[model samples]
Target: MNPHNPNRHNLGTVISFEFRRTVLKPKFWLISLSVPLLIGVVVGLIALSGQTTAQRVESQDTASVTFTYTDASGLIDPTVARTAGGTPVSDAAAARAAVVAGTSQCHIDYPKDPLSQPIDVQGKDLGLFDSSRYNAVATTVFTTSIEHKIGNPTLAKLAVNPPDVQLATFADGHATAGIAGVIAPGIFLVLFYMAVLMLGNQMLNVTLEEKENRVTEMILTTMNPTTLIVGKVLALVGIGIVQGLVVGIPASIVFGLLSGSMGLPEASAGVPTLGSIPIDAGAVAIGFCLFLFSFLMFTGLLVAIGAVMPSAKEAGNTFGVVVMSMFIPLYAGSLLVSDPHGVVSQIFTFFPLTAPVSTLLRNATGGLYWWEAAIALAILAVCGWVFLMVGVRLFRTGSISYGSRVKIGRALGWTTGR
Candidate 1:
């Protein structure tokens, strides 16, 4: 039997058994369901809290204002101040007439000295159409005045921004919708963070599991350790994908149903929002690709460590080395979000193992070089080969021996027939 053929080495049996345990196990389902459940509960709680606050503000801010504009032309700016906020009133005469008819709240009188008040609506508890009956429109009119004063063009199309008086986040009212706007991006940041840790840690567990059970030896007889290891890593990656979707779905759905953004208060609510907590398809693809490749490379290293370590405890020390390699890339990816083209980001982008995470992050938030993507992929592929070679050496070295830890010096000396 050819020694290089894993089938002859007993590796194939282990691969099949690894597939069965991972695919049929309840643990797979647990991992898949975990992220989603966690995200749903957190988002639901936040939404609930925001709604409760909205109700309190609506009730307390009941002061109203009525503008009496005797003349339309003289009524220059019939802005009203009231329960919600302030707005410019173009049809002041009609509104004023409504006030006389008890259909409106207050009136704005532009006395001959226009500069004295200078087209600004003053006084309090004001509404153009009467908040008691038409509080909604009345509130709109009050806030429009402030939008005009602020020189916002969005008010022209939207004709309303969060009421100007909502000058402070909670201002006179609860801003559940406003705050929702802020939470959108926050959700993505958090999910991305969770995915990395979840996938990375799981990869570690799996490598240790195979070694601890002594299954690696059984599988090496039929398939090359490289193929066996790579396939197992791919399968685990598929599992991670399932987990990510489960968590992101509900947060996206609930956020979609509500109005506005995730921001505590959108700089201007009602302005078109990106809406739909979307993961960039390109970013997701690139990120996952990077994650998977990085995962494979690390998995190879893990497998080798697991194979040689006498027990799982010894494996922990080996992981420290893996952690060190990950640190630079993790930090680079994070900072790349801020300045993808910055010197540090550009430097890390060239490194194969670290490049995957950093380059993808740059692709997601910051624009990275077009050529860098291809380069990063090719570089990682090569790195994967080198890691595969090391892993096989470790496996071949320790597969037949079962004793204390396998030292690196003896492990590398395998090629020299030491």
Candidate 2:
């Protein structure tokens, strides 16, 4: 706390050294670049496959098929049926018998009382989707016959296929992007987890590296543990920011180029240019706050675990458990979105570990109320601070306890030393 403290002066030095130590590694750049590159490769393959399939579909007439029809409704034009590869048959029984006997490809029976009886279509049992071909062929024949009767092709076409209806929703007497507005906060949620997942190991390594190298005692002689850990946390945050830019920028560029062709729903359709997505400023503010506190909470907890753990191998399983806990709320993601006030969602929103992700998800879906956001943010902020304090205490007690795990009771002053 002293202004003249050398440890305070050395804080900047520690941050610089830690930041340079991490970013200078070849592995860091490789892993950072690989995420976007890997995603690009997978998406490229899927797009190529889709294009190939579309080409194959266009190269062949998928609807062409042979069938027989008996139109007692006087609706079937003989010329149209023949043109569509459907032969007109007088005996409906013979038509069906021919199909059953394999003498015909399929049979369609247009009942005399078309108003009361259904049109019957029979074909060899093909798979579910493929077997609809008989109905498709018969439908084309009937529609084309109706078009001829109407005399005006355009009018008949309009009568058969009505104009599409576009539905728009308004909020506050103004047209809003509807679901697009609701999902806009999800960008913050995505960035939060992206940094957490990418930087979790780094949090553990930052503190553990000193212990592993037998340098913790020596380092503590020169710098306060609090300053050292705080510096490392700050440096890790900087690294996360850089990595986020690395991954997020390229992804944004690729998505902007591909969104139109990707058939994204209206909410996120087309390139997400400025002012295109209806983002609620309040929701985004809440989301950004939650993201920051959540990242800090996870960082503090992971760093605390590193302080207590003697080696990476000893901490691996614990690290996996903590990571899994962050995703637990996602399993009930649908419930969170559909019924944010539901019992399950409430539990996840308040629980120490699950609160960050669950609340972020609810905020993204427009389900998080302001009061709930306040409570969630307060909980995360307190937990982050508490976890950081716990990490410092654990480091003081366990940093030099090599080849053994530290007992929480002693590390946290819950029990006296022997």
Alpha-carbon runs more than 4 Å astray in model 1: 1-16, 63-196, 199-224, 248-281, 320-335, 414-418
Question: Per-residue lDDT tens digits of candidate 2, residues 1-418?
Answer: 7568687688898789889998999998998888778767776777787787677544333667888888889988899889878887888888888778887888888777866988899987767656766777777788888899999999999999998755566656655555656545776777778787778888998788898899888998988999999999888878887886787667656654555555444543322342334556778789878888888888889989998899988877799999899899999999999899999999999887999899999988878889988998888888888998899889988889988888989888898978
lDDT of 2 at 146: 87
* Tens-digit lDDT string for candidate 1 (1-418): 6548544344445445555666577876676666566656776777777877666456434534334433223323343443233344557666656666766555544445533633323233334423333344333553455466657757653654354555423323532233333344344445444555565555555445656676766756655656666566656655555555666665567556542433444434433344543333444455556655665566656666666777777667767766676566665565776777778877788776466556655665536555777777677777876766776677666655555776666778844444
Clash totals for all candidate models: 50, 0
Question: What lDDT is obtained when candidate 1 is compared to the true structure?
Answer: 0.56
RMSD of each candidate? Answer: 12.2, 4.4
Q: Give me the displacement of residue 359 in model 1, in angstroms.
A: 2.4
User: Candidate 1: minimum summed lDDT over ten consecutive residues — where?
Assistant: 68-77
